[model samples]
Target: MAGNSDPLTPRAKIAVTAGKAVAAASRAAGRGSGSVIGGRVALKLDPDLLARLAQNLDVVLVSATNGKTTTTRLIAEALRAAGPVVSNALGANMPAGITSALAGSSDARYGVIEVDEKYLAGVARDTAPKCIALLNLSRDQLDRAAETRMLAEAWREGLAGSKAVIIANADDPLVVWAASSSPNVVWVAAGQMWKDDAWSCPSCGGVMQRPGDDWFCGECGFRRPTPSWALSGDHVLDPHGSAWPIHLQLPGRANKANAASSAAVAAVFGVPPQVALERMYQVQAVAGRYDVVQFQQRDLRLLLAKNPAGWLETFSLIDPPPTPVILSVNARGADGTDTSWLWDVDYTRLTGHPICVIGDRKLDLAVRLEVANQHFQVCENLDQAVQLCPPGRIEVIANYTAFQDLRRRVGN
Candidate 1:
């Protein structure tokens, strides 16, 4: 087996050089970071480019419907305590992006990759990672991705006989079902706030009985496995019963849950819980998720909430009433063309806050807010939206593309 030094073959070297040139050209052309396009071109030139690039590195793959990017970033930071690490830091999570990241840093000792939920199986197969972190999964981009159960089954089937250690979330039934097939697994009791998708058992299609934090299928005897690591309020408890305080710059219980999972994955790489938590504390933002930008004398704390589950978490992190809140939604390809998912989120949570809506799908959000009996103004853009709020610190929560658009406008 290849170890720390896996030199690229001649063919791979040519492919990497070509990909780098394309990526540079793309950046020069202002077409955004060329990670995806570069990877696509490299893959077309060499079909086995990703597998080849991942040859001798200790790779870790993080996948979920939510928190995957943040978790991936956390895990990467934690792993850096041991050695040099290469990661798709920009949230480009597909095979091409992963390939581009790996090809760029062939000498890095570790690879921390964030895999798209639907593409986890393929990435796992290619990388043969040392550890795979399976975070919570819920409905997202329904038009482009399969249902959560189907994705779970694919995860189960794809990772059946893998040698890698699976670090999985025990609280999520879908994640539990997916990781159950793996023989070597480390379970983390990362809290699952969205229980709508996990009500039915993925195993027997039976009703899942939830007693406290434990969930089980009464019909088939499928149950939540005992976790080795657990999140207790603001602390993470390891198997040895050691409590490590999770003091992260990132807000929300969801991020604390991500920290717990990240600690478990870091432990797989021989990084202690305390050491991992300390390293993860420095991560203030993940690709502009919680970026606080200065705009029009008001500090705009940008929060990215792509789906219902994500929105629920974002609401918990926002400031209370009187602190204005901006809700933005865009139905672009990256944000999922179907804006119907907006209805799944409870807009009533913003009832007390002074609300303003802006984006391509602002009308959709306005109708939802109106139904929730929340008063909101539909603004043309972020400039107008920020102008509506009283100066100070304000919360700006936006879905995928809308958040990206805002970030671009703010020069993030």
Candidate 2:
């Protein structure tokens, strides 16, 4: 259904049609949403299909180790106030999944994409985004992804000479170093909760000096840029010093930072801060991050935390002590094969809560919890885990694949 002005060729049209058919078949087979496989088939038919599908629409690319999916969803919601926007709302951030999303909505006026950190440069080249949001960079999927500093360097090199307006996090040193190459950047003082990855300056390999919410490199003079937009407690302050109070349905301070970044990106698209914030306030969940579902007379709140940085933020979102928490983890390909990152998290924080562990890697988690001097019950499955808990609201935090499995089982 692409308009006449769009550059999709006859072969590309056929590819898109075939991809739709494949997607339909995949959905029927219950093999997943079929976005990635469908787009893979389309690209096989037409290697230039992604660029062709992205021809005339304004595009925005969001990339980060964490919060890419949530921030992409927030920005997409805010942009929808302006016009029809197509986005990978299901947390699909790869090239294939992105192409599938665009191909599904040919007539959309705007395309908001979530690009994986490693694939940001390639997707940006194809989409020619109008704006790019660079959230914090932290170590995730270490078995697969490059180290934090290397990824920051790659972002810096990959985004060089691009015409896109970069909306970056000023509080994250890795993000600042990555976005500094761009001539046009809107810096947002989104607070970074996990600072372990940025203790050393990425620019000069020198020790970083932090004093009173500001950071500077002692060896090379690299410092945190003056933010045009900042998050001050419960309110977001614009460059003009106008504070917009954010009342989002999402929980945690991490989401507040995400909102600040989203509002900045929406402003570049000519959306007012108030309008953008109002629109973003409507989003209660991203993919399945904070969805609550019923299971065996108990309310299960589903939370996804993939890395140490993510886990640090997720801990604050849980209900207070004695509210019972269920922690699940998996070391599948989607999640990193290495479970060494488990040592990085402070599981001891859940000391007073009734905790249950269930996953493919439950034993590994049990060892970590044991080492942390925390008491927990190791269950065979979710049913056993829930049965052990008193019937009430329980928090469930899972990593990537385990979260998906729980979503399927709970039918959320």
Candidate 3:
């Protein structure tokens, strides 16, 4: 609990107490995630809870179709150079989660939060954040989030005339369109690995041409914005060609891009680029991502792939002639009921890689892999999958719920 001299008023205090009590009871009952329910109750009691908690804080909001959690963690790690940083690192990125995080850490003056794609605008308005990290947009949770272009337009409308300094991905055309409305913008070429969502111009509904790293729409004048920061090979290069060597504990070019995005936001906050990059090296995992755990006498490195775009980036992270890979998919409420997005992915990329399928949607994955002509075995369960995998370090790629289940099973 915060100190007695906390800034919250009497009504806010009552709301916070009720929220904490509900959280405690929920945890004791093992019913559901206490973070969401508790926050919902608190907001119902004190509607202005978030706005009050965000007072005098340097709030940084991170939102994307993917990588938001990891990028938010990276930025939070870098921002620690300033002071104690409060963040929701548990992958609960809605109003309830954000409120719970803020109400829990009232003393902290800096907050690095990962906001869900649909809720970014509302949260940004409530917090009036100092900086906003706009990463690439893609097709994720099509049933829940609708189309990626719709989100881009909503973001564009939401961020109009906002004083927050926007750090945006220049490589993603959708991101560029979204952040264009912000008056203060810093564009970074973080490299868009998935361009399927941006093949057509969001501005004029015209076909986009990608010549080298630059993209232009011949029908509309919309083109890739000139970037202030870029990733050249392994180094994060600035305008002067000075390189900041990023040695991350998290393996992947995608993570390196995430680190660069964080570094860009940190720079805008007056933190040195070198300090930001150095801090990012210390982050090995975010909410069970890229964590190696021992289960049933085998070592498994966990990676979360929720959508086709995410799968594309995840596949690039694997080395040539990959290790034994366990691919699990679940079409639960959290993972989205629709699993048809699997066809959008180029599963042929994993043709040479040994694979195993596990989850409620295992058969669906099996059929998809068979159609792709990728050899894979369907396991009865995760343990069976582990038993069937070749002896040595194995990579386990799972969707949302399956990833959470594996993390709990590994005693994370």
| Clashing pairs counted in every model | 0, 0, 0
lDDT of 2 by residue, 217-321 (tens): 999999999999998888889989999999899999999999999999999989988999999988998887898899999999999999999999999889998
What is the model-wide C-alpha lDDT for candidate 2?
0.92
lDDT of 1 at 244: 94
> What lDDT tens digits, residue by residue, belong to model 1 across residues 56-93?
88999999999999999999999999999999999999
- Model 3, 1-412: lDDT tens digits are 2233556788988888888889889989986568888888898999998987887578999999889999999999998997788998887899988998788886686889899989999999899899999998999887898999999999999999999999999999999999999999999989998998999999999999999989999998899999998877778887666898988999888888988889889987788889999988889888889988888888888999999989998988865665888999999998899999999989998877889999999999999999999989999888888988777788889999999888877887
Q: Which portions of model 3 miss their true places by more than 4 Å? A: 1-6
Would you list the clashing residue pairs of candidate 3? Answer: none
Reference-based TM-score of each model: 0.98, 0.98, 0.97
In candidate 1, stretches whose alpha carbon ends up further than 4 angstroms from where it belongs are 4-6
Q: Where's the lowest-lDDT run of ten residues in candidate 1? A: 1-10
State how far residue 195 of model 1 sits from its true place (Å): 0.5
Model 2 segments more than 4 A misplaced: 1-4
Clashing residue pairs, backbone N/CA/C < 3 A, model 2: none
Distance from true position, residue 216, model 1, in Å? Answer: 1.1
